[model samples]
Target chain A: MERRVKLLGTGKYLPARVVTAAELDEQLGLATGWTEKKSGVRIRHYVTTETAAQMGAIAAKRAAEAAGVSLQELDCIVCASGTAQQEIPCTAALIQEELGLSRTGIPCFDINSTCLSFVTALDVMSCAMAAGVYKRVLIVSTEIASMGLNWKQKESCVLFGDGAAAVVVGQTPEGESSRIISSAMQTYSEGAHYSEIRGGGTMVHPRHYANGHEDDFAFDMDGRKIFRLTSQLITGFVDSLLAKASVSKKQLQAVIPHQASGMALRIMRTKLGFMEQQMVDIMADHGNVIAASIPMALHEAISQKRVARGDCLLLLGTSAGLSLGGIVLEY
Target chain B: MERRVKLLGTGKYLPARVVTAAELDEQLGLATGWTEKKSGVRIRHYVTTETAAQMGAIAAKRAAEAAGVSLQELDCIVCASGTAQQEIPCTAALIQEELGLSRTGIPCFDINSTCLSFVTALDVMSCAMAAGVYKRVLIVSTEIASMGLNWKQKESCVLFGDGAAAVVVGQTPEGESSRIISSAMQTYSEGAHYSEIRGGGTMVHPRHYANGHEDDFAFDMDGRKIFRLTSQLITGFVDSLLAKASVSKKQLQAVIPHQASGMALRIMRTKLGFMEQQMVDIMADHGNVIAASIPMALHEAISQKRVARGDCLLLLGTSAGLSLGGIVLEY
Candidate 1:
């Protein structure tokens, strides 16, 4: 029996402050328009007082409200952020606390595979719902790239943003069956070094913090290398995923991909033969929000009615693991 | 219509170097036998040439071999460590890279709720298997606690070790119905600060390394606080979990709680009415391996014939999130 799942509601939270390319370039002493031409991100949001957990809480509350459910009704919370605010308690637990629902006693944990986390988390939540282990699973993806970006790395720093997105997952209504039709993941760890932050972990202790390389503590990327590798790998990944689900690109009402870069999205759109309108690209405004990008874009698509009831949606992304993931589901 | 899950096999890898309490005491200028009296940890393993991902890969291979499956046959790999080797590209991805399985592309990710991670990973894997999304899953728990231990804090420094444990999971074949009967988790974020390492995460930037507090950059613990809280809350957690599973403590053939401390286990056994023989404790030799403790203990129990086929096994633990978790399964 194929288990069905539905997005009861979707929500996103962007920080109040938006930084334009001109402002960033001016601050960094780079030429104006450099960020836009290089990364295709004109403006991106940055949190001033807001934290990752706080943004996630706001997104969660909105999702719960839209789902027509109270916070206490969530059977589980899965946090899929690329970065966590702390190392001790999982971010999901903190998010629960931030939402004022701390003692509700639902199982809270985190699933991280870097940028692919949200899509991967969706797979885990889908399976949990299918097995009747959870009636409603709340998945939250929040990233604060602003704090970790190396201002010196113009290529990556300009392309990143901070935000959060969330969804309340549950079974489809009795008469309707909105199930995850298929999913697939392909990890090529050879490209693991393409994007990484080696510090802020055991491999590079704070005791040796003074021995830091310029890029070790902050997010860094070999943009050209990753672009080349991803462009080569993404086609097979998407094809195999579609074949597994027996889904066709022509059948999809919308394709929500990781808002990685303007150039990357163009490659994806052109290669997949997806129409300009069919592909949802919010990168110019939101930039690459790391793991938060996909669901945030999905929330926007749904809110704008670009996606509606009975629409077929495809979510895909390339993560820091050099991993490619895709999920085919009915809205 | 309960979905059944079975332990296909288990494996463990302890680092080559073993550090005795006397050695640590002398190195840290502590009185001899101080560690033994306080934590009941006599000896613990420390890594020299081995890294977390390397040890994890070795354990994973053994688990796959024992299960009569090749690494390639596994549908997914979930690394459930409290601390990551690096911040980006999760430890699971790194393990995949090390095992020479870089491009095989099965879904790989990490789940963490601190020490309860293995048990939590089991729940996630069981649900995935039950839903038929994955036929076989590999779960790895590895900790490099040695690298983060605060040598000045003798209470916590001597209580931890470095090791890895892996398990191969799948459905019980044919007529056998061994499966996860039930489980439960409770997180109290009020105690979230009871034990934590504030550095090596987004909460503390490496740039602030020079401003490190005496305890901020390394593992610090309020041992008495955690012990007191666990003693107060564990009996209810175990009871609630067993009740939901419709089982009794008397039916459990073996209980493998996290090898946190000899003291914590004693409190658990006394409060839960579990016999000394019913529980497995390897803390004296292995010390507390953080997230790797429970599975490593289970691996030892199975290898030593303390637990066998048809035995009702219970896995449980207290984690840094001030979370309590348990799983009842007949193996």
Candidate 2:
């Protein structure tokens, strides 16, 4: 019998401090109801810069404990992060060392496709498990978007928050039928410039920093274009995934799209004809956590009993690099 | 029958200018023969600020073409680079857009375990192929250590180079003899501090650049510690791989170890009891290209007829993150 990769456990972590829309308005001079009417983000978590990696490590530990496995049992460590501690050695390696699993012969690495990173990591780990290359894989998606925020740029600053989420994936008997059914991914490089943190790459040397390009260092976005592209891609990809899994639109128990923007989610639901109740949106409280959004939403839905065993959950994610991916998981 | 992952093609690109030990003496006043006698490096390639990413992209394109596939045929892009174009969207995504293949649903990401990245990437892609999740995958390892140099730090500045190499991996017919057999990987994060670019990461946010800490930006090394670790890990891992493959050390046709130092290789060979001629040491010309070294050496060996059909090639790689991986490929 062919082995199937199953999602065993999920967990999420958000920094302690929460900033309400009113407080944000007072701080940044935004219009009243701007956060609510535009992105439905009434409040969001903000890390003190010292807690991003710690939060991610905590999330992974929770997932592992919930999975009933010790750190030594993990065969691979895959972390997807938009905000990393360094540009080398990979954050996964550091996390592994922090967890004291560095001596276990587990190969650790990072995967980045922007907000799609976590789901993309799941796809990669699933393939590894199905191929018998790994038995247990720990995937962590952490984002410290607050670090990229320019307080003066209210448009971009209010949309992002800091958080991390993790899930443990392993193989189970095929008869269990609780596994990933199908996944579809798409990328449009032309749209990469639509949203980006332009500074601190090879193109711009670290030492060549000048203050004039402060906007380039902080998060920048063409919000209008992002909304349109995100809605169209998410709707199309989710539909493709549903069709490939041979499941009707109504059969999906819940849709977990990235908590990017509330308006984007509304447009996607309407375009795909998904019921309002059938969709799970956590951006109202968490803001856009970048790669951590989808997994954070999934964890919330599962814990709230919004989804149950044998139910089909549709996950969609998109971000800078204009990368998009969708997956159907039966749990 | 289980399917196999095959190496469809190999390609490499090295920067034009070569810096010799004599030239190093003129540039940094380093003693003659110290580099050669200790690290066995006579010359190394140095990339001008303009050539790093372009060289990597060219190698990737050549590999794709040699595999008889256009960029559109690729489903995934994994670039293993110690030096990347930027910290966001990944260097792989940039390469995808540059190659004009970003619209093909190909998810691009980067994997870094220092010099072990290429083999780790190969191992990751193998699982993806065996699981039938992707029909084609491109893996590239590129490094521009020259850019990470402190010209005043003669210990490191004289022992590095810039280059890139790529390979196309995909499904092969069952029972095919030419394929990757098995791989063993191990990471020792306890030594993670042995070699690293100390200042760039979140730990030392560049904005807090205080005076008198210039050493943090340059690559730092405890050469004695690395020498001891590399010799032991390479011999032990390669032996384990050979035992698993049921092949004897004498049957190995060629050995490709990360070109960190010539003295390290000599110690590894003596300790492992392997013939000197069977080992490929390109460090004399390329220094330590980090992740790019193994594939660059493989490309040269294949082109020079040193590796051919039915030959057993053992590749051993080790570096920062203190990661080590070995793979036995039949060509």
User: All candidates: CA RMSD in angstroms?
Assistant: 1.6, 2.4
Q: What is the TM-score of chain A alone in each candidate?
A: 0.97, 0.95
Write candidate 1's Cα lDDT for B185-301 as tens digits. 777766677888776566676667676453677777888888888788888888888888888889999999998887888888888899999999999999999999999999999
The candidate 1 chain B region of ten consecutive residues with least summed lDDT is B205-214
For model 1, name the residue pairs that clash: none
lDDT of 1: 0.86
lDDT of 2 by residue, A1-331 (tens): 1237777888888888888888887777678877666668888988775545577788989888878888788888888877677655677777777777756667777777778888878877787677667888999988777767767667778888888899988887656888888887777776777887766555655565444554556667888787777665666677677888888889999999988788778877888899999999998899999889998999999889999888988888777877888888887
Off by over 4 Å in 2: A1-3, A49-51, A173-175, A211-213, B1-3, B49-52, B210-214
List per-prediction Cα lDDT, in the order shown: 0.86, 0.77
True contacts kept of each: 0.70, 0.46
Using lDDT, give the best candidate's number.
1
The segments of candidate 1 whose C-alpha lies over 4 angstroms from its true place after superposition are none
Q: Please give me the total number of clashing residue pairs in predicted model 2.
A: 5
Quality of candidate 2 docking, DockQ: 0.50
lDDT by residue for model 2 (B209-312), tens: 34555567678888888777766666677778888777788888998787777776777778889898888888888888888998888877877889877788
Highest DockQ model number:
1
